[model samples]
Target: MTRYQPRHTADVRDTGRRLLVRGGAAATVMGAATLGLPGAAQAALPMLRYGSRGSAVVTLQKKLRTLGYSVSTDGIFGPNVLRNVKAFQRRAKLGVDGIVGPNTWAALDRATSGGSEPDPQPEPSDPKPEPSDPKPEPKPTGSRPMLRPGSRGSHVTYLQRQLSSHGFWVGSIDGSYGHLTSQAVMCLQKTYGLGRDGVCGPNTWSAVGRISRPRAAYYSGNGIEIDLRRQVLRVVEGGRVKWAFNTSTGTSRTPTPRGTYRNFRRVNKMDYSPLGKLWRPVYFYRGYAIHGSTSIPGYPASHGCARVSNAAMDYIWARNLAPIGRSVRVY
Candidate 1:
C-alpha cells in the first residue's frame, strides 16, 4: 500500500472531500444492506487503482517488463509508466487508453504467465572481523542513542530521518539517540514485533524502507495540549484536534506533574505499583498512566497518572503515539 503522508501544503482538500464522500457512500451501502435492503449496487463499486507493487499494479508492471518495456518495477505511477502502458495496450489491440482495466489485465496475464524474470543478483556477504585484544567499548544507557545527520558514522541518524519521514517520532533527528529516539524505535519495533532494542539495525532499516509507500505521513510541529483545569487531553495533529479525552490528573505533592512529555513505550497489560503487578502502561516519564479506573467518578484521583476507563485505555493504546519526545504539553 502507498504510505499516505499528510501533505499539509498540498492542495488535497478536494481529494479528501471526494474520499469523504466515497466513504460516506460506502457507509450508506453497509447501512442499507444491514437493513435487508437490496440495490446496494455492489458490482458498480469502482476497482481501486493500485499504483505499484500492489496486486493490480504489480501485474501491469510485470507484463510491461516482460514484453521488453524499459520500466523499473518500482511501484510509482509516472508519465513514463503510463506511456509504456499505453504502448502495450496499443500493441495488444486493447483499449489503447494507457489505463489498465480488466481487459488489459486479461491480455497481460496471458502474455507473462508463461515466463518469469531472471534471478535477482545475490547480495554480497561480509565476513565478521576477528576479535581484537581490546574489546569494543560498551554503548551508553538512558534515552536512546542516535546519530546526527551529516555527521560521520551517522547511519543511525540517516535511519532516524527515514523513520521520522515515515511518521515515527525520533526527536528532532539531530543524530543524538536520546530518550525520544529510543522511545520511538521501541514503539515501532513493538508494533512490527521486531526486537525492541531501540537500535536501528538491518532489520529495522528494512522495515523503515518499506514505509516509502503512501509517502509516510508525519505529525506537524503543532504540540499536544493538555488542559489541567478542564481535565482533558487534546491531541493535535497539524493544528487540528484529532482527538480529545477526559482524564484525571494528580493530587497533592505527587500531583500529576503537569508538563510536556513525549510518549514512549506502550503496554497493553503492564504491572504498576513498583510491586510488579499487571496493568497497562501508557505514557512514559514519571510512570503516570491512562488506565482502567472503576473508582474514577470524576476529578483528580490518580497517584500521578491519568485515570481513564479500561475501554478508553484500549483506544488510547491503539492510537497511542509518542514518537520519542513528541511534545506532551500540559498546561
Candidate 2:
C-alpha cells in the first residue's frame, strides 16, 4: 500500500496477513483466525512499553513508521521508541506517558489505514520524435532478458510479478522498470548475495526459482537454521518454515560453527571492530551473527559470520523473525 526505500527502512498484522507475493500479484498468505480489520500481516499486537521486544514491538514501530515517524523497527522498544510514543501521544491528544496502550494502537491503526496516498507521478520526459523508425533496436532474445532501469514490457511485468510474489514489493505491476522496481530488484539481489547492481539477470532468476519456505523439523518452536548444503537460511516457526532466504556462509578457513545456539543480543546498526557495518544483526554467538551484507556471493565468503543480504536482514528486522533467545541451529 506504501512504497519506501529502506530509512536506512523505511515495515504489518495478523488473522496474520502474511503478504507473500504469489502468481502475478501479492497473494495474502493468511493463517487460521477470524474476520478482522487490517494488520493481519503481523502475527499479533501486544501492549508495548519500554524494554519490550518481539513481533508486537515490530508492529508498533511499523505503524509509527508509516505515519512518517523515524524509528527503527528492530523489535526493541528502547528510549527512542519511548520518546517517539510520547511524541505521537502528544500529537493525538492522548495521555503522554509513552506507554502504547489501547488508545495508541487504535490511533496508529486509524492513521495508517485512513487513506491511500497516490503513487508519485513520473517526471515529464523530453518530447519524442514521430514513429518513423518502427522496428527500433532488436530485443534481446533470451529466456529472460537482463532487465535494468528504463526497461519495460510484458517481460518486465513477469519479472515484477514474480518479485512481488516472493514478498519483495516492487510498488506496482505495471510492466515498468521504474525506481520502485529497481529497489525491489536490488533487495532481491542482496537477498542471495548477488551483485547489488539492480539488474534481473541469470543469477537473480536462479535465486528466484529457488525461493521457498522452510518445513517442519525436530524443533517445535521458532528458530533459524542455516543449511550449509543448500546455502539458504530457513526461518522456522512452530515447526514450519515461515520464510526462507538464500545465504552465503563462512568460508572453509573461517567456517561457521556446527551446533545449536541462541540469539543472545541484537544491534540495530553495528560497526564495532571487525563486524563492520551490520545493518541489523541478530547475534547467535560472540561476534558471529546472521547479518545483512553488501557482498553475499552464492558461495561461502564471510569471516565466519553467516551472511544474508541487507534486504533479507531488513525483512528479518521488519518482521521480528529472529528475536533474542530464539534457537539457531547451524549445521
C-alpha lDDT values of all predictions: 0.49, 0.65
lDDT for model 2: 0.65
Which ten residues in a row are the worst by lDDT in model 1?
Answer: 117-126
Q: lDDT score, residue 99, model 1?
A: 66
Question: Which portions of model 1 show Cα errors greater than 4 Å?
Answer: 1-223, 275-278, 322-324
Runs in model 2 lying further than 4 Å from the true structure: 1-154, 163-220
Candidate 2 per-residue C-alpha lDDT over 75-140 given as tens digits, one digit per residue, 9 for 90 to 100: 999976786677667656778998887777877766666533211111012143212222333333
TM-score list, all predictions: 0.32, 0.47
**Predicted candidate 1 versus true structure: per-residue lDDT over 1-331, tens digit per residue:** 4998656633444444555477786655554444334443232222323353454455455456445443545666565567566656655667767666666666665555542221111001113332231323223332223332223235555555555544444433333454445544554554455765656665665566465311111235544555555555555666544444445567665577766677675665645664123246556455655454533333565677765444334434434433445667766
